[model samples]
Target: MSPIEALDFVGVALFAATGALAASRKQLDVIGFLFLAAVTGIGGGTARDLMLGVPVFWVERPAHVLACAATAVLVYFTAHLLESRYRLLLWLDAMALAAYGVFGAYKGLAVTGSATVAVVMGVLTGTLGGIIRDVVAREPSVLLRQEIYVAAAALGAATFLLLDRAGLPLWVTAGGGFAAALILRGGTIRYG
Candidate 1:
């Protein structure tokens, strides 16, 4: 697969895992976990597609849905194992945010050829899943927090745009964007 496609897959899996973990915390059944995972994995992309007037990626490719379902099943059976590690879920969620932010921004830029709109799309893609998950799970959404989550997404998108303008390869820009967001998010988790 292409680098961008691979990154998208990874981001989907990460988000699926976060959703599964959240469902586990809420004592959801397998079906509920799968539902949440699917929503979390594709909700942002679906929203972006709708806004951009493009076909939703997951709808075009059923593999994305399959992958999310697989992740939810895996998490459902291994919930106890995962729960034993207190911070595992949190870190995974952060990774999902970073990866999705990068991929979403890249997709937006690809579609609109505008850095500002791409950044907005990036933030939406990174945080919207969590917003949906929290609303469904009855928890306070992360976006409502004072933490630097949205700032990190914006920074990642801006970095990606700068690298793309500097003639860097797309893969390099994507990796750098994901890493920048990850570091910023990690710092936030550490300090805040």
Candidate 2:
């Protein structure tokens, strides 16, 4: 797979894991885990594709759904072992936010050649899944929390666009976005 596709896969898997962790907190059954996993994994990308008038990603590639299901099952059996699933979820979410932010921006720029669309898409792709997960789990939404969550996403997305526009290589742009997001989100997790 190309680097972008691989990062997208990683983002999906990480989000799915976070969804399953949320389910575990609620003492949900395997089916519930699967449900949350699928939604959290694909929701953002699905929204992005719809808004972009492109084919829904998981619908076109069933493997994305399968990856989510597999993550759900794995987390179902293993979530109990984690002493702090919420902490793990936060870290995984940070990673996912970063990956999805860059991937979404790249996709938007590629499709529409519009930096505005790219940044917006990146924010949506990074934040929508966790928002949906929190809403479904009846947990306090991360976006609603007084943390730097959405700002981190916007920073990463805009960073990717700016660096790419500066004629940086893909590695630099993607890595810069990812690092920018993780640093901001990580500070939130550490300080709050």
Candidate 3:
């Protein structure tokens, strides 16, 4: 698979895992986990695609749905090890945020050839899943946090764009983008 598609898969899986954790926190059953996973996995991409006037990916390719559900089931079985580890969820979300941010920026640039639009799509893909997760979980939104979130996404997106413009390989630009995001969010986790 291409780097972009692989990153998208990783982002979706990470978000789905976090969703499963949220479901466990809510004392939800397997079905609830599945629902949350689906919502968290597809919500941002769905919105992004709809806005871009493209086909919603999961609808066109059902494998994405299966991946989300399968991730939920795996997390459900392993919830015991993850209980009381919301920090892990945040870290996982951070990774998801980074991966999706890169993928989204690349996609946006591919379609529109606009760096500005790419940044917006990157941030949207990065954080929208967590927003939906919080909304569905009835928890306070991450947008309310003072620590880095959207900023990290934007930084990553911009970094990716810059690196891409420099004619770096896709893997290098994407890895740099991911590192940018993780470093920013890591500081937040450490300092906050």
Candidate 4:
């Protein structure tokens, strides 16, 4: 698979773990784990795909769904081993958010060819799933502009676009963007 596609799938699994963590926190059943995992894994990409006038990714590749389900099951069975499960969830979310931000901006550049829209799409791709997850899980939405969640995504997306425009290699741009996002979100998760 291409690097972008791999990044997307990695986000799927990591976000699935985040979803499963949420379900575990709520003391939900296996079904809840499955439901939340699938939703959180694909929610942002599905929305971005729709807006981009493309097919939803998970529909085109059922393996993504399977990955989500498997991650949920793994979390269900193994979450108790972690010292602080919520911290794991936050860190995992940061990683996935960064990867998804780069992937989304790259996809947006390929699709819309507009740096502005690409950045917006990247932000949406990174944050929409968590927003939906929080809403469904009955938690406060992170998009209340109260934190650096979306800002980190925006920074990552913008970083990618700028690097691309500067003629940097795609992988380098992706890496830079990912690091930008992870560092930004990680700082907040650690301090806030």
Off by over 4 Å in 4: none
RMSD (CA, angstroms), candidate 3: 1.1
Clash numbers, per candidate: 0, 0, 0, 0
lDDT by residue for model 2 (1-192), tens: 777777799999999999999999999999999999999999999999999999999999899999999999999999999999999999999999999988999999999999999999999999999999999999999987845888888899999998999998888888898899889988889987
lDDT of each: 0.86, 0.93, 0.89, 0.89
Scored by lDDT, model 2 comes in at 0.93
Write one digit per residue (lDDT tens) for candidate 3, span 102-160: 88898899888999999999999888999999998998888787448999989889999
TM, every model: 0.95, 0.97, 0.96, 0.96
**Which tens-of-lDDT digit does each residue in 1-192 have in candidate 4?**
766677888888888899999998898999999999999999999999999998988888788899999999999999878898888988998998998998999988999899888999999999988998999999777677446999999999999899999998877888899999999999988887
Candidate 4 C-alpha RMSD relative to the actual structure: 1.2
- Judged by lDDT against the true structure, how good is candidate 1? 0.86
- lDDT against true structure, model 3: 0.89
Backbone clashes counted, model 3:
0
Give a tens-digit lDDT track for model 1, residues 96-149: 888888888999999999888999999998888888888988877777774577
Error of 1 at 124 (Å): 0.6
